[model samples]
Target: MVLYQIYPRSFADSDGDGAGDLQGVIDRVGYLELLGVDGVWLSPIMRSPGADHGYDVSDPRDVDPLFGDVDTLRHLVEALHAARMVLIMDLVPNHTSVEHPWFDAALAAGPGSPERERYFFRDGLGEDGSQPPNNWPSVFGGPAWTRVTEPDGTPGQWYLHLFAPEQPDLDWSHPDVGDDLDETLRFWLDLGVDGFRIDVAHGLAKPDDLADLPDDVEIAQLVVDQRDARWDRPGVHDVHRRIRAVVDEYPGAATFGEVWVGPVDRFARYLRPDELHFAFHFALTGAPFEAGAVREAIDSTLEASRIAGSAPTWALSNHDVVREVTRYGNGTLGTARARAMLLVELALPGITFLYEGSELGLPSDYSIPHDRLTDPTWERSGHAEMGRDHCRVPIPWEGSRPPYGFSTSDHTWLPMPASWGCLTVEAQIEDPESTLSLYRAAIETRRAWPGPRSASVEWYGAPSGCLAFRRDDGVVCALNTSDRSVPLPRGEVLLSSGPLPSGPLASESPTGGVLPPDTAVWLRPH
Candidate 1:
């Protein structure tokens, strides 16, 4: 099934509050239905302190006022279902905002409080009272531990936060914690959401004994804590099985997990039948724009699915990474290359996630002034020397309107890129050759031909600046990565990203015809 990702704040502002809300999403249900996506995955909309956007949730059952209340969310979900679309909400169970009542109660009750054990808290002070129990650093920068004062006027202990200091990691080992999560899942499932996209799903469990990182490592020490404990723990599968049982009680329900790791083998484990229905393969999205590399990634993912006996999901851009267009487009790549990339991703096996702005062929804008930056990552790690604000920019909807129809108000949470005015949904919808139309066409084509249960794919030529492949359905795809035309053999063109040249294919030829640079062609073999 085709899935669309909506970054709530940047999607559309129905109330013109300068920030998108559930009502705004409900208003755009027709837009998504018309776009031909079967499902939509919204970023977190739960109650939070906005520490890491909505990822740092304070209440699991309530909706964040920034997005809307519970009633508005229910209406949005109903609208999507009425349009024959599924709605998937983000589930951030890894941590909670420090402002959450549970955390506050834990801090106030000291070590003896029953709720205190629900979180990771240390007793006694470090050599310096301000120091943490271990040398772990926060993912956002600084020490992972934040000191909390005790009620008795004593120096309080520090707590561990894998991400920002305000987001403290949950103690999954606690029995009550698991029960709380199970109840949370049921709460949403009863609300009629199709499923949940579990944030950091692999991070539910951690090593019992906290450890320190190597002295020479330059990356944040928090990485060590996460890698060493939370991710891919054997115990995590049990937790998944329990959650799966809960989801199974509801028909047509599913789960997707965000398992970020370099090894595809480890990532695939999260997709076991009893575990997550699917987990994102970030490796393919992170690969360079090389044909061989792309082929290798695709093949590896397919192989991993076979080994794991589970379906996989593919993604190019999300709230977490740089945009696909900005990553691959260098001003010279042209729209042809971008379209080819889309075809590659769509043709791959399993579910596909389309980020909000990718259909418009929008590239990330790196011109955000320092003062305009809202991403916490920008302020921490010095922007990681890899600006992410570009991908997080507000989406452009109306071509001529100021802020590109993202917001009617004078100011937005994040500045809209200047280039958005000319590249918007309203502008492209009317243009037959526009990327917006192409995306709609592509989605329709995929819907029409779901492909064989097991489609065989073969490479027919070298991947030197150009690549050619044949699918099981007698469809041949030829892509030219350079600017020059590439010769092709005789074949009837089925689809093309750009203008097609006049030609007829023979049974066999000594050499193929030339293809225009950055262009792609799908043909039927003679």
Candidate 2:
């Protein structure tokens, strides 16, 4: 399946409120249908306090006013359904916004109360309880545990927040969490959402003891490496099983995770039949633009998925990382490589998630004034890191300048570049050579391509720094990572990321013309 991720705040603003709302998604249903997506995976729109965006769920069963109300969400679901597309809402089960009612009660109830039991409320270390419970650090930065004052207005206990302080980690071992999740799943299912994208899916369960990491182990590496006390705990599988059970009640529903575990095998564990329908394997997402690196990542993840007896998933860009254009090398080369990778990703057998603005070949905006940066990582890291605001900029829809028709207002939650006038949707809609057009053509070709639902691939030998792979059926996708043009495979070129070199036709030459560097082509072998 091909799913498009729409970051709500950056997609399109319906109200002139500087934020995209549920009405925005409703208005854009036709645009998604035109893009040929099977479904829309919306980033969190759940009720939040704008802490960590909507990922810090204030009310899992309701919509955030920043996005819209619950009734508007129903309209979005209905609109997507009318367009023959499913709606997959993002949910944060790992934690909730500190402003959530539960967290408020947890604070008022103080330590050892049932309300406080829902989260990790522990006494600090040292004689005066001044230190944190452990040495764990927040994923954003600084201490993971934040001390909370008692109802009596005195320093009392600390709570764990693996991410920002606005997000307090829930205790999955507590029956309250399980009960709340059950109610949440049913609420959305009843609301007509076809599926869910579980945020930090592998992080719900923490070790009972909350042990400190070894002195040599980096705090940041805990989640990536397996067997860590903080994340990917064995009990996490139980949490998935519970989610799957609830989702199974609704026919045709799916549950996928935003897993970032290392060594594909561990990542595969989250894909067991009774657990998640699919788990994201991010090896390719982080791989450098090189033939060997990409090949190894693909092979390992596929094999791991095969071993786990679940379908594989491929995703290039997401909200958390740098845009592919910037990652690949930026400017012309970056756009070319980004386009090339999209072709390769689509050619693979499995679901492919297209990030918003990726089809238009949008690059990260480096010119955002530092003061306007909203990602918490900036302040959390003490300004040492600028965070992901560069990539999370509002999309250029159809206008000549800032806001780019994304909003009727001149202002956007995040600024859009005036230079993006050339990259607007209206500018590329009719240009055959535009990145938008290439994406349209590629998606159309892929839908019609002959192949089994579960297809296999065989690697083809090629020049150094180039990789070629063919579907068991007959389609071949070859990519050139080298700096120079390499001979194209002898096949009828179906689609290409960039232009191919001119020479003798495939019928005349065994290798045809050279394939441009940092480009990829899809072909039907003779």
- lDDT per residue for candidate 2 within 1-526, as digits (tens), equals 8999999999989989888888988887888877888899999988888878887888899888888898999988988898888999898899989989999999888788999988999999999999999998888999899999999999999999999999999999899899999999999999999999999897888888898877665667336555467878889999999999999999999988988788766788898889999888888888899999999888977886887888788889999889999999999989999999988899888888999999899999468888788999899999988888888888888978888889988878887887899988889989999999998898899989775445358999988999999886688999999987777788898999998876544344465687878999999887
TM-score of each: 0.92, 0.97
Runs with alpha carbons beyond 4 Å of true place in candidate 1: 216-227, 332-334, 382-387, 482-484, 502-513
lDDT of 2 at 456: 56
Q: What is the C-alpha lDDT of each candidate?
A: 0.77, 0.87
Best by lDDT: 2
User: How well does model 2 score by local distance difference test?
Assistant: 0.87
Per-residue lDDT tens digits for candidate 1, residues 1-526, read 8899999988888777888888888888888987899989999999988978898889999999998899898898899998999999999888899889889899888877888888888764556576677776666766678888888887778788877787888888888778988899998889889999998887777677766655554443222333454356778888888889888899999998887654666766777778888777676787667776777777777766776777667888898777777678644363556777787777665789999988988887457777877777666667654435678777888857557777788577777766566678889888988888888987887777646465336878744777777767666777767545657644876667767553342123323444566677777777
Model 2: lDDT of residue 301: 75
Q: How many backbone clashes does candidate 2 have?
A: 0
Candidate 2 displacement at residue 244 in angstroms: 0.5
